[model samples]
Target: MPDLQRTRDPERWDEEEPPTLTTDVTIEQPKTIITRNQSPDIAFDRSINAYRGCEHGCIYCFARPTHAYHGLSPGLDFETRLFAKPTAAALLRQELDRRGYTPAPIAMGTNTDPYQPIERQYRITRGILELLLETRHPATITTKNHLVTRDADLLSAMAALGLMVVNVSVTTLDRRWRAPWSRGPRRRASGWRRSACWPSAAYRSTSSSRRSSPHQRP
Candidate 1:
């Protein structure tokens, strides 16, 4: 028998298309920019993340679970909705100005990619690096974006002084494999090689698939 109940009640069976995902940003005023790590295996004790939630929606991203704290879905929400620390540079300088503060190489992109696409507009990452350069503070950066080359001039000077290093991490070299999880074509390892060699950057091509998660590793 035909279900007359559903026929009369449109709410029972109406099918609506899912909404398209769009990028949204929430400005976060972080009181402090330097995050200290105590893990012995961690090379740098201090690090900073310019933004939370990466546009590169790698399904296997370990950090995806972090988005749950915001009352958002860790899957799509982690990539579509993002938070930016616009005052990162100012906060970093303030912390560095504190008495008894010791200089150590600060690491960027430890938790999230600091050179994410939004970096083009915010320039917070660049500002932080500029401050590091002015104070002669050493820093390390790891990214998947070749856009890091935009700061080549500043980085070269720092590298010359043994104050900086840049590492470009490519998870999968195959273009087809990355399309579903990545926003665009992954930057070529060849370009990163040129960047590393030209600026004398201490950059290495590390494959993500090769390493075990720090939390899971013995």
Candidate 2:
């Protein structure tokens, strides 16, 4: 898909009203699992997002606006409202097994956090990881949730083969940062320190971007 702004014409706002969400659940059955990107700044050409509209509800999330396409507000709706692609792992395996498939590192946690709360039960990310391990495919993940630790054993084995790396985001060290508007933020600096030894050495912003204002309703 094109950049959000480019895809949404400003003048079209006066021509047609945007859609609205009737319920918090959204069932998105996508035709493809991996999204291809040719952006210069990105490290990978393809990515897989198991779900849409993160329940973490980070106000600063760039993915928030995505829910608007389903006629949902980017605020509360982006958190409470959710969509899952149940066949993501199966779809990924199919693509990887395709003829002339070249194995490049596949990125996850791009559009939405793959290890979010629902992942505990849904286990879509874990299934994908298992498939990656079976195929010896290189996979990378960037997430804010500690739930990634649940798959530490698999990750450790993959690390031995140089097939996996994980980056855990620490948007803030302040407890105040944790609320409906944002996901859990590390309240202790030591907590952030321990995460540094993970395969990726850097943490995401420990503070929200100063330029953007919270998109709260009136």
Off by over 4 Å in 2: 1-24, 179-198, 206-218
Query: lDDT of all predictions, in order shown?
Result: 0.75, 0.74
Residue-by-residue lDDT tens digits, candidate 1, 1-218: 86565245565345332345688999998789999989999788999899999877766678889999989889888888999998998999899999999999899987678877788998989999899999999988877776788888788778878888777665566665553434334454544654663333323324443552221101
Using Cα atoms with residue i matched to residue i, what is each candidate's TM-score against the true structure?
0.78, 0.76
Question: In candidate 2, what are the lDDT values of residues 103-136, reduced to their tens digit?
Answer: 8999999989998778887888999999999999
Q: After superposition, how far is residue 99 of candidate 2 from its true place, in Å?
A: 0.9
Cα deviation of 58, candidate 2, in Å: 1.1
What's the CA error at residue 54 for candidate 1, in Å?
A: 0.6
